[model samples]
Target: MMDFDVELIRRYAAENKIKFGRASSKAVIGKVIASMPEYKTRVRELIPVIERVVEEINSMSIEDLKRYYSPPVKKKVKEEFRLPPLPKAVEGMVSTRFAPNPDFVLHLGSLRPLILSYEYAKMYNGKFYIRFEDTDPKTKRPEPRFYEAIKRDVEWLGIKPDKYIYQSDRLELYYDVARTLIDRGYAYVCLCERDVFKKYVYNGLACPHRGQSIEDNHELFDKMLNRFFNEGEAVLRIKTDLNHPNPSVRDWPALRIIDTETYRHPRVYDEYIVWPLYNFSCAIDDYMMGITHVLRGAEHRVNEVKQSYIFRYMGWDPPEYIHHGRVAIPEGVLSKSKILKGIREGLYTGIDDPRLATLPALRRRGFHPKALYNVILKTGLSSSNTTIDFSMLAAENRKVIDREANRYYGVRNPKTVYIYLMDDVEVKIRVHPDHPERGYRIFRLYRGENYIYIDFEDEKYLEYGDLIMLISLGNFRVGEETLEFINNDV
Candidate 1:
């Protein structure tokens, strides 16, 4: 059933709920007959049981009637939730990607875009890619280990991307694009200091570097590639309207030199000193990689405006963009800086610590991928910030585990009891109450093998004439001392 149908069904399925204008089940049958009407997912099977319950109630003794009818537990259907269609999508040709920095393991917030991108790609029979945006080594540094860790986390979630890439490896491509723009006078090498250019751009005035000849700009840009310019000595700027409202967008920095001798890239080492910024590399890669659509958080909406200038200057058709609001888990340590610090200070064991909201942490806790699908699709493609709790996911997780996980019994604060069977008999136990088709686990109870364990907490009512069920094994009545085997009804 759809999400809207779930609440109505829940109220109808409540204990002693009326089905018609009044009660539907007969006086003797009670609410059990009405129970079948509330379960639309299992209506085919429940309908037959309703008729059988009505037929058998007349002959059933009052004692048996009390045992026969109890409300069935309402369950979340295993079926996946529905999501809205992608805007302006072209089936079989549409492509999407989840581009993440490999600085740390992905957290729950990352799933919002990652799942949406992957599902949309699968929905359109198109390609999904994972591009590591690992260009900034000074501040948001990338580590080699997290490269594989991120991929492993994605695999654990059953996502297989069609392609993978790293922006750090494409420095030459960014350099080549920068050269083309400089030669065409769409971009120029700025010699002005950082504060100097900010004042010029924001004041609706062009810096001296902005009005340089095409040859001079090309010469300086080639010098930048050849390491002739020191860090912060020069930068390539994409020319935009100085009078634009967002001054940072006007003449945005496309590429800049980093002092690799002090702050080195993990992969490239000190080989390259210059790197493309987020807007530049992203737009260029989106164009080169034929990324048809971009699904990212709404915080990047301004970045889209910045990137559009590069695409416009290059006469390239930019990818379609969809921005969503942030996804937050309040109890989670989502900030990468905080997480890294926690690990360094030994506050957390690692990225997969049970306290974390990282994908690895969730996987380690036995969460099913269906749990994530249900939660994400319910919050699908919206611009509203969402706060999620772990229990919300665990509730959906139990639905799947309840049907599949095998039965195992464990008791804390144990109490031992000895019982001698009248004769050797086999005790049969179904693997799962809801799924008897999985078969049963059988063990023969020897006449002399009489010891069993129960929780000491259950010793509260240990008196003379009381019956207790050993789960699926059998029913036993308490005598003067030991629990006596009465019957195997349960």
Candidate 2:
């Protein structure tokens, strides 16, 4: 055993427990220490220090230490293994992915997950892949422009995925795994009608074919395949325990038959009968892609658990799951679908309409990518749902722009006002009051002229004969709230 400082470890561990949850102290400390590249290399030399610390901690009274060091509750051990020897080189472990279905353009909700994945990948020096989960040809509408838009948005936000993978390209891989599962007696074909199948399975009601062997169902499946599936019949399902409390654990559909009219595969020339379900395809892809960290919205938390079972059944290592909240727009705000509808109906100009939260709209509104990044940092990662005020984002944007942008005078909504001049003179006016170094421009004035151009709102504050100031120039008495300017030349 290496010599370690037991007392120091106890103090550090107690402080960590107070900071993080009691159960998270060790992991938190380990993570913190591992993050320091310099310290990671000296871990072997530091083992003695850790041993001494543990020894001192062991000497403390169990009852007294209970107040400081709350041991975590023991969990049921599903597997057992001895700790491996520390490696010579510190390996970057985190691998995250942004899996977006190509059905719609990326939204604020999707941006949150991408940001989390990107940040984690950067923090751990890990690889992050942008995977297009473009399954379900029935619902998939491949818009090349949408993919281009997403790429531009991600790049603008300073996020770069290590590689781009498409689920459509991996259909053969999914089919191979599906066949493996079927061969292993882990999945079975169900030849039930769509509506009837959903009603029975979702309600947890037993079907007559529930416990039928795959071999026994093969002939029936063939008949159904020929009559319904090939022509236009059957769905495939995983044979999980029906008594499992979670409805998701009950034999869930792994594949479904699609109508020829509704389906259009990108690569497949002929109409296909079977299609991998969401959970099945996602689990297989994540495992194959070596995704170590699965960071996604909390809405998919249940789906992650189901995927975990799929991984377990296949004897594959399940990735760490981090569920973050979904981003919800204010009520009555248009959804992406509604926005698309608006575009189609000519209700709005395009996807970049200023009212929507699309990246192009944000860019046009003068919002910097750094400001959007700061918003994500401030929001952090939470499993609970959170709503962000649009104004809050606007405020952050203003701070960034105000620091770098120079003020310019723009006479929008201008109206003619009159000011009496005793003599004809040329006045020099600075283009910007605060930026006097930018120099001045000459404006010719007319003798006996009583009017100049000003915004209509400015006229309201001026009394008929009240003194008004033209920025940086001598004050002038307002003759009257007149719309006439002294000749177009002046």
Candidate 3:
């Protein structure tokens, strides 16, 4: 309508300026037209009128622009991460662990738990440990090299684990716990077909073999441990409510026979046949290792609930669980499967590819560890998921790198510029303008053939009579294939 307020466009553009560092006129016009209910149907004709008003807004003086719109000034505050308190007293006896599967190197997502565990341990003056959960040798198989690679990544993050434990090395301990559970009438050895069990579970009924006696279940469990039962023939299920609302929590499978002869583990190749599932093994370790606190993503709350059953069965109190929302980089690939596939298909150079969000990639791209720590600490344990832009991370990194990284000029598509001069001149340029104490790099321009190469990037923006100043050198005006010195004043 002719009475539509046009000042709304400038107001919206100023709000966007705080977010994107600059207001886009096109974006402002589109937003203004979309905001009007009557102009929705006449977008084609309204666009030109809205665009013309936006143009006028863009040409306003900076001071006048500020009068219309400006971002609020935020007072700086010291960053202090607020994590939930541990359930029990931490009298320097607290122990925490970072259990990572060594299938691939650590990434940004992995660092979330790692940093939380490590920092909490240090905060309480307690011990920190690193545990490698490499039980799944078939699907997400672990590699031996990744064991050391993960250790290196943890150390690079400035975390030093007091103890390192491998799940493969503790297979015997899990077997002992499995035997205890079977003999205590808490677990049963399942020999039913996969489809048959699924039907029973779907109907909220226990399988026929769930009624087996403790002695009979013990025999089947021993048979499983000794490899008498084939991989798909048997599994050990924890006795839980079949009619539970959550089907996944209904009689969850604790251990299954993995035919290591076919898919061998890198650490203990073909040595064990029976393998414990995630909840069972993780719960058992938490109890055995005296872990006081567990920090993980909210996605694993199901695991926490399942592990509670294990703790109840064993007559032990489970550790405190702290769950935070998941995080992702808006521009980088954080998925492990995608990262591996990209490297295999030549879509990425490796895990260290700048396009990926792995620790190695960020390290290669000149990101300081403290900068990443700052971002994560600021996020804290918020329940909402975070999808931060890559520019935000880069801005944080620039603050740290700016103080240390040396300056260097890279010429792109260079073109020769001849300066007709009578005498040679030596120009002294500081290595870093702000850091003059570092030293100077001297450049000598020849007397007879006074010529230098300028990047085409800078050349393309200049006109025949445009005056510019080269760093540490005097101002000069662009001439026909030559630079005419205008003034040598400092």
Q: Quick one: best lDDT, which candidate?
A: 3
Per-residue accuracy of model 3 over 115-192 as CA lDDT, tens digit each:
878888987899889999999999889998899899888888788899999888888898888888887888998999
Deviating ranges (above 4 Å) for candidate 3: 1-91, 420-425, 446-449, 460-467, 477-488
**Candidate 3: 10-residue stretch with minimal lDDT:** 15-24
Clashes of each: 0, 20, 0
Estimate every model's Cα lDDT from 0 to 1: 0.78, 0.65, 0.81
TM-scores of the models, in the given order?
0.83, 0.66, 0.79
Ranking by TM-score: 1, 3, 2
lDDT of 2 by residue, 1-490 (tens): 3333444456665544333212123343464354343455567766556545444543444355567665567564432222221212124777788987666666656667788777777777778999877667676655566667778888999898999887777766776776677667777777667677667767777666666776755554555445545522566677776666777667887766655355565545234555677899889988888888777788787787667768878999888776777777673234777888989998878877777777776677677987777777666676677776566677677756655565656756688766666567677766554567877777676666555566664545555544334643345555544422222221
RMSD of 1: 8.4
TM-score of 2: 0.66
Note each model's CA RMSD in angstroms: 8.4, 20.7, 7.0
- For residue 214, model 2's alpha carbon misses the true position, in angstroms, by 5.6
Best by TM-score: 1
Instruction: Give the candidate order by descending lDDT.
Output: 3, 1, 2
